[model samples]
Target: MVLLERAMPTTLISMLAKIHGENPVVSEAKGVVPTCTCALMPKSGGKQGECKWCWRILVNREGLWFRVLASRYGLVGGRLKRGDRNGSVWWRDIASIRDGDASVLGSWFPENLSVHVGNGANTLFWLDRWVDDVPSCVRFSRLYDLSENKLATVAQMFSWGWKIGGEAWKWRRRMWDWEEEMVVECRSLLLTALLQVDTEDVWTWTPDPVEGYTVSVAYLTIIDRTPPTNNVLAALLWRKDVPMKVSVFAWRLFRHRLPSKTNLFRRGIIPSEAQLCISGCGQQESETHLFLSCTLFGHI
Candidate 1:
């Protein structure tokens, strides 16, 4: 079997070092034994990257922390019921940084977050994830990529006259056949949402059924977004007769993460070898060949 050092992220190994309990030392060794619960989780910044737990703690503070900070600084930011110019500016600056660690953390949010359009002053015309719970940019990505102005606001797009600081139509005057079709599609979609200029824009958090953000709801949202895996033969793993450890091994095997020669070679745990079959076949080793196809092992 592969050692835990070879399998888990290095940051977790470092965290395990700081824990002090009856079995204080968390080793790099791998076995079927369960780890101790007394291990202390590492704080914020660590060797590999900012802790995801820490990142969540920070991002979820958008509702409360920013307001407290803004009140202290004589400025405003974060989620709003009735959008104001100062609050809108504050949110735009923070939300649209569009890169690095902060951006990565922001992507963890599910599509459940939505905007309640009012005056449309605070809502971004294209970049923000709003239409049918998806960003207009993502929905009409091709058109967004081709558009001359990428950062236009919804108010600007809906405004009738350029005389009052409304944006003039900035799309390319000439369009290819495909682009023309996309434009038609965009027009059809946009025509359905009419803006109410007198009303104030409301940023809505819809992760919970009750219409507010909660720690539990956020945690559930994150859990719901786990990356999908295709474990086609997973049924064999949960059979009543199988040992728990064996089921775990079977699960890892399906993920192509078992400590096979090919996995070790691919994971850089061992140097490349020309052959791996115990029966002396010269073929390259892989999960498929090791468990299902190798002439010697397949029949076992």
Candidate 2:
């Protein structure tokens, strides 16, 4: 347990509690606030208005959104009821079946979510992302793809028996010997984790030491996904008093990553040879030749 006065944000530290299930309740920072403006309200269902942050939280199934939804729409009352704005209607609007909830959920709830399987009523057996930070279908795709009830919850699968091919054992689609073994293994894994019917399944955000989402963490997560850019010419490109659009173009030019005809040709997007410069120079156009050696261009 490495204690620190200031919090450090790293995917590694976040994965610690997730992979091992060592839940340490750290004291939240003083005067901490929810990343969402919805938290400011004494009570909320997001019916009247939801800020960008709250809407994102609801979409990701994180923070108050997850809690409210998991509580069977009883957590937050009023206009944001089951079929209302912040309920199933909101979910359907953003995460349609055609678009696939997995894609939408995946954008926010990456591998850092530690799903505490409780009653298993809401925790999907194969699809809802209950176990191992990934969907059971993804981990055991062979069995899941063949199984008839793809959206069945953990409770339903365990209680009524997993309806492979949507029928009882006598008339259900036959499973290969290996698939049977895999099914047994899958069942064993779920059964091993004692599900407390009294408790509801919870989705936790793991990036913060206190298990709360922060804008900083979210920002860093996005940066981590993007390829890093060189800062060598940043000072030159982002000069004081320069307009934003001009600075952006300057930055692109500095990096030689602009979608110019020559660059596009080099990237195989253009069929024309790289010899004819846009300025009509006879020499083969290159980043160095364009700005520095071209006979037509004035030196900066």
Candidate 3:
């Protein structure tokens, strides 16, 4: 370990990598011996995000030491030692645990690992800690290589199998809470789109009274809600006592007769739009000429 007078701000991995993973604890590879290779596998264990194989559980990389684990852990799915039988075989079932026996880790180990057990086994690995220079992409490849022994989802394999720069991490991975919430939100949005719930109900809406009435109604979703809200006057010409669009003429008269911003209709204050025009034979074309007092239509 190196100590410095000034502080050095760095990433967690860089810090750990500097002190430990930087140096290969074991000069030889783990699980490379010709011994039994029965990596512990989970029978039904992805729920807790823990590896089922090699019951040696860990929260993160801090627990990557073999000395702390030793015989207490089951082997995770990894390379098989030379004499290693299938997964069902154990040290107890090996029939022989001696260093040269073909059925145990002791047998196929390289000369460095061929010595005493425990401390020696630990020493071999301490000298051979993982090669730090291997890119994270390569690190992921190692994991996937080990993962091939078990069932895998396409997403999982793609996630770990992908290699980019020397470093690798889940590029677009979501946390459990975020993933769950987004799934629900997306499902609802999709359903609404399929049902067309936010569309206009034109068929059930009141029919347009003129060529431009539909456009006016379209603008009415928020600006106006009924016929009275429109600047144009409306009259029920098709189904009323006045069959000749008389009501249309009547409201038209009412609008121009009143002043701008007039409350005439608001409280029935003023006269008609026709009243604002000349009263026939005169200066203004008031309602008198168009219908009632007009000399044109013959004084209705």
Candidate 4:
């Protein structure tokens, strides 16, 4: 675990802190749980330094973890889609991340990840972002609503023929002239989509296609997309020279996770009347007051 901690990038540590809902120091103390490092191992004859284990189950479809989940819950567009009530707690958590319910990590997956249609068996015809970086369902909402085969795969649609007057165009009702024009546009969009009969569909990490997905890259991408605020200070909090306890203290202070009287009252750990500065300054013992504004402690 210490070796894993050493292997982890500082940015990734911060990201994991956010995920685990704890300060980096506490998270580090817990240590990263062991996962299959087989996926992290470099391919035969590949670069020696390329091997690094990351918490990735989405893109590593061939990995044992992915295969086990896929076998149980099934997959759509090389991903586990929502609506599996029978899935395990872990699956639900992963689903939340994949479906954009887990905050930044959730949103990051869809925006930075994409699918390359090969055989198209693993690619959703409407939902996967295989064409032009946007899902067909999102691009052609009306057509998608009217279509009967909403869950159909790209290979299934192509096999049924996606062109005009094809069996793939199973609509709920006859479309008006304008809607038919949308169908025309949709068909034209699929004209260039050629599926490979021999190759399987694959997910591509858009930021680094060749190197593929890495937690470090994903963390950096999230940081980049996040509007800069206290980010600079947050980045500075994690330093090799600084003690872990100090960094954790700073992190808690910044995020209001400290056990200040105000925070304790807020969490129902104490009564409101008890939420006063320990120095008896009359001000609430909030983080700011205790750390920066208190007449007694502020001097130090």
Candidate 5:
């Protein structure tokens, strides 16, 4: 053994002490927070309000919303939990499922053509390759720009048109439908990572858009609000020459809220009055009510 010259820094010694098995006690990456299952509070389950992690990142988001199962050798495994809001931090997994979860891909598809019967084996093999369900499911796979820092929004679904006879997939129904479902499923997977919305709504997990079809989520976001009455309501978006309606302008101006033009005039215009009106108390509705002091406007 060689003789040591100087004592190591206490911080360095302490960091070394944190080593458990082969993993380090402390992570070097910034903007990353560690969480324990215990800290995860169940918003739905009986564990109502208790936080699960030792410390929670104030804005701990899950990144990219893509799916990957890291499993291998019964040692490492878990799903990439909240991939939506983008907790873009380096993750040092204590355990990962490197091969176990992905085994379906290798097992489902063999090198023999008999294994890929008419439509039966082929579809199963396709899904396994793409990490999709064997049966129908809304797929949302996408390639995100990790370096650009700007996120891309992939359309959630698109219809698949395949003709089995000539060009329409060339004269087959089962194959066409199978092919179509596969195409749409692939699109779904791509879109899930691209868009951030509560898919449980009437939208999401629906049929793909038809060819040459488009839908604006922006339009869906605008809530039905009260309309505006006078030219003052139109503000800059209004003029006889402009030929614009106050209601239409109101949406562009305030991003869709309220129930009607008159409602904006009465309730959303002033803050206290709407609250007071229902309470049978005192509240005034005015331009200041409509413009300066309303929760609906979102000016702040």
Candidate 6:
């Protein structure tokens, strides 16, 4: 049998242990806490100009795996572009997760992931949460809708100039007096925003900024956000005494992922008429019917 069923429980437990083992004090006092720089300092790349004092140097960039995805799917401002209909299965799945299509963790990534604007070259002007807690597109929906170039990056817009009569204010048509006031308000907000010409924009994971992103922490966060019923079901699904295949079967049954006739019909693997229960109960062979409501197997 496959190791999928047996490994899940052990993996979950290990992840939980790792999450619990992290020091609460260290995590909370991350940027404020001072540390000894005696032996841990870099040997070769000591201090370079203003980089030594800049916190952007500590921000982690995307890894090889993410870079590979970006290369295949296309990248916009150091982030993966939205996947199209012609994209591969893996890419589409990833895109769905990024777009908050996942039922369990809706909008988690977008809510937690924020950009620390530096040169502004690698941050979206309207979509990224750099200026405020929410994206500019959301905060100024009316202005965003009127904009001619909705896809402009922060640097691009800044270069064009963001002042009232600047070239960056390219709208579809003339704005009303109220809209002009809104633009003034928007410009006023950006007045204090200073862009560092040398530093590149950095993406930060809000949950654990110090250690950055980790699979264990992400998994734990997802589990914590899941509904109590789902958590309870998952806990009950992987029992130490249960056989691997049996556990797998139960999991599939519960998830409606088993190859039932109704599911097969839905996937176009079987004809609609052929989706009747094999037990001849004149009902669709769905997980609920086959496992719990079937007169033959259900009672057995």
The candidate that wins on lDDT is 4
Where does model 3 exceed 4 Å of error? 1-173, 188-213, 225-300
TM-score versus the correct structure, for each prediction: 0.42, 0.43, 0.15, 0.56, 0.19, 0.54
Pairs that clash in candidate 6:
none
Q: List per-candidate RMSD values in Å.
A: 18.6, 16.3, 34.7, 15.9, 20.9, 18.0
Q: lDDT at 6 for candidate 6? A: 33
The 10 consecutive residues of candidate 1 with the worst lDDT sum are: 40-49
Q: What is candidate 3's lDDT per residue for 204-266, written digit by digit as tens? A: 122332331122233333123333423223321222444455555545544554332233434
Best by TM-score: 4
What TM-score would you give candidate 4 relative to the actual structure? 0.56
Native-vs-model 3 lDDT? 0.28
| Runs in model 2 lying further than 4 Å from the true structure | 1-93, 96-110, 162-172, 209-211, 226-300
Residue 247 lDDT (model 1):
78
lDDT, candidate 1, 90-190, per-residue tens: 33323322212233334444344566777766667776665566776788888787777666667767774323233434566666799867766766667
Model 6's alpha-carbon lDDT is: 0.62
TM-score-wise, the better of 1 and 6 is 6
- For model 5, what is the alpha-carbon lDDT of residue 125? 19
Q: Rank the candidates by TM-score, best first.
A: 4, 6, 2, 1, 5, 3
* Model 4 Cα lDDT, one tens digit per residue, 106-145: 3556666687778988778887788776788888999999
Cα deviation of 242, candidate 6, in Å: 19
> What alpha-carbon RMSD in Å does predicted model 4 have with respect to the real structure?
15.9
Rank candidates, lDDT, best first. 4, 6, 2, 1, 3, 5
Which residue pairs collide in model 4, if any? none
What tens digits encode model 2's per-residue C-alpha lDDT throughout 1-300?
113212423333335445555442231322222223222223322211222233344335434334323333332211122345554434443333212333222344334455577887756677656756577778888877787666666776667754354231221477789888887677666555677889876655566537455444543453465443555245434655567888887667656787766788878887876547767868767665665567876244
